[model samples]
Target: MKRIAVGVALLLMAATSAIGAGYTWKNLNPIAVGT
Candidate 1:
């Protein structure tokens, strides 16, 4: 049970990080191209 909880937490963290990175790139790409 403990291991399962830890695994879920790690998965959520990774997913959030990936999403954040994608958004950051999306926000940056237009400005980067414009420049």
Candidate 2:
């Protein structure tokens, strides 16, 4: 049970990082296009 909890926490962290990267890319893309 503890192992399963740890696995889920890792998955959540990975997903959050992906979302953060995508959001950063989206925010930067418009400036890049404008330039």
Candidate 3:
């Protein structure tokens, strides 16, 4: 059970990082294109 919980936590962290990176890319893309 503890191992399962840790796995889930790591999965969530990875998902969150992926989402944050996409969000940051979206926000930056326009400025990058404008330049």
Candidate 4:
């Protein structure tokens, strides 16, 4: 059970990290604050 839990955790981390979306998101941040 511990091994399975560890594997799932690793997969989730890898997937989350792989989500780049190729966006900087800085533009949206400045716009939201009226900068």
The collision pairs in model 1 are none
Task: Mark the 10 consecutive residues where model 2 has the least summed lDDT.
Answer: 26-35
Candidate 1 regions off by >4 Å? 31-35
lDDT of 4 by residue, 1-35 (tens): 99999999999988776664323354456675465
**Candidate 3 Cα errors over 4 Å, as ranges:** 31-35
Which residue pairs in candidate 2 have backbone atoms (N, alpha carbon, C) closer than 3 angstroms, thus clashing? Answer: none
Residues 1-35, model 2: lDDT tens digits: 99999999999999999999988887989787567
lDDT of 3 by residue, 1-35 (tens): 99999999999999999999988887989787568
Worst 10 residues of 3 by lDDT: 26-35
Collision count of model 1: 0
Q: Give residue 8's error in model 1 in angstroms.
A: 0.3
Rank candidates by TM-score, best first: 1, 3, 2, 4
Give the alpha carbon lDDT tens digit for every residue of 1-35 in model 1. Answer: 99999999999999999999988887889787567
Q: lDDT of candidate 3?
A: 0.92
Per-model TM against the reference: 0.81, 0.78, 0.78, 0.55
Regions of model 4 farther than 4 Å from truth: 21-35
User: Candidates' lDDT values, in order?
Assistant: 0.91, 0.92, 0.92, 0.69
What TM-score should be assigned to candidate 4? 0.55
